[model samples]
Structure formats: structure tokens, C-alpha cells
Target: MSLLHRIEHPRDALAWEGDMPTLGRYTAGIAGEKFFRAIQEHGQFLGTVCPICEIVYVPPRLYCEQCFEHLDEWIEISPIGWVHTFTLVHLDLDGNPLPEPLPLAFIQLDGADGGLVHFLDEIDPEQIFVGMPVEAVFKDPAERKGSILDIAYFRPV
Candidate 1:
């Protein structure tokens, strides 16, 4: 029998009905906190270098999957990269058409094995292409929060 079917008070399930209110909060934990802090405080981009396979992960990782070793080496990487791939989105998550199309891309930063996924700005969707060079644009230092959004967006270099 389902656990919910055996509840002592049927009112237990009703709390989930009809646009129930919710309180939600989250913490980014250690790895993420450090990564974003680098961006916010220093305007620097960072990555983790796997000592075993030598692959560098941007948005750094605490460990490596290939050799199962903990990654401890933090390296600074250039904010410049190429558009590895991209998509043009015309609709919002709710299926509503946006005022303008947004171009999003996976950018493989120079000197790193992994890449960052972010929105591409200052260009039309029809003009973006694979291998297009781009660079990060950061929010003003005073305006930054410790988050990936601290990068206002990536734009053609």
C-alpha cells in the first residue's frame, strides 16, 4: 500500500491542494560558494584541474571522475572562449513567447577542458555560430552577488 493512503489524518494530503503556499531555501555549499566568490570578489574565472587526467573543469569540482581522486588544484582560466554549441529560444519556460529571442551557448573556455553554459548577448540569433569567439561581461563589482549571474552575460569578443 502507498504510504500516503495510510495517513492517520486525510487533511495531511489536502495541504498539497489548490496552489498551496511553500517556503523554500537553499545553500550552494562549499564548491559552488568558492567558485562564485572568485567571480564576485576578483572578477576572475577559475577551474579545477584533475591531477590524474589533467582535465580542467570550470565551475570547479571537488573531485575527478576518471581516476576518482579529489581535485585540489585551482587554476585561473581566461574568460574568453568559443561557442561550442548554441540554441535560440523564442519562448519562456511557461511557453510564452519572449519579447525577443535569446541565444544560449555552451562556451569552451581557452586552456580548460570543460566549459560554461550561459546566455549570449549583443548579437542576433541568426548570426551566432559554432566557434564564435566570446568573452565574459561581469556586473559592476558593487552590484555582484556570489553567483554565476555575477557574469551579466557573454558577448562576442
Candidate 2:
């Protein structure tokens, strides 16, 4: 039997002399790209409103989930929103303790039926309450690249 070796770090694994098959490369499709671009370039929030149900989807959808209608109406939505719900996470993505607790929230933008799950900033975790009003803080126009991170985080209003 051969000894089993473990990869402690990605950088260390680079020393291996074998083919490393990789399989993960996720991407946000066309609708998401369009939404991100609007925010990244113009500092605007975009949503798609369904004509049939009048429901709006943020991160605008190509088609309505409810009525299955093709969504063609793209409307701008306010970045100001309320936190529908949230959680205080104390660990990092690697399950290690973070220096501080982070608030992850589901923010429901005004005038939109659906909400977005994103990080919250500039507030104490203890002070975080459901229905708390928040607003998006975007990166400088020159720094934006049409990514969700373009809006750094939502801060208490």
C-alpha cells in the first residue's frame, strides 16, 4: 500500500507533477450580466417587471417564474431597501473564526417583489434588525467592472 498525501494549500499543490483536472467555473448568464453592467457603469439598479403579473425581479430575469412570460420591461429600481432577514456569521469561508461577525442579509429593494442576498456593512451585528432600512454603497465609477461586488455592501440608512 502507498502512503496517502494531503494537499494543505493550493500553492503547495502546484509542486505536484501530475495532471490536475479542474471542473468548476461558474458564471452568471446574460440577464445577470446586463443587470451587473447597469450598476457597474451607471450606478443604477435594474429590474424586470412582468406585464402579466406586474411582479418585479431584481438581478432581472429573462422570463417570469410565476407566469412564464418573457420579461422585456426593464425598469430601474432604487438601491434603498429594507432588510427582510439576516444572519450574523462569525466564521470565514474556510470555517475559521473571523476577526468580526459579518451580517449577511436578504434585502428587498423598494418597488421590487424579489430581494437579493448580500453582505451588510457599517453596522453592528447586535443592531441589525429585520426591516431595517439600508442603501447600497457602490465602488467608484472608474473601479466598477459590472460585478455584484460593484456595490460593495448595503449600509444602514
Q: State how far residue 30 of model 2 sits from its true place (Å).
A: 2.7
* lDDT (C-alpha) at residue 11 in model 2: 91
- TM-score winner among the candidates? 1
lDDT by residue (1-157, candidate 1, tens digit) is 6876686777866656476588888776566678899999999898889877979988788878788788889989999999999998899999999999889999999999888899999987889999999999999999999888999889999
User: Cα deviation in Å at residue 61, candidate 2?
Assistant: 0.5
In terms of lDDT, the poorest run of 10 residues in model 1 is 11-20
Instruction: Assess candidate 2 and give its TM-score to the true structure.
Output: 0.83
Relative to the true structure, candidate 1 has a C-alpha RMSD (angstroms) of 6.1
Off by over 4 Å in 2: 1-20
- Measured on C-alpha atoms, candidate 1 has an lDDT of 0.89
Check candidate 2 and list the clashing pairs: none
Worst 10 residues of 2 by lDDT: 1-10
For candidate 2, write residues 22-81 as lDDT tens digits: 998766676788898899889999999998998989979999988998888999999999
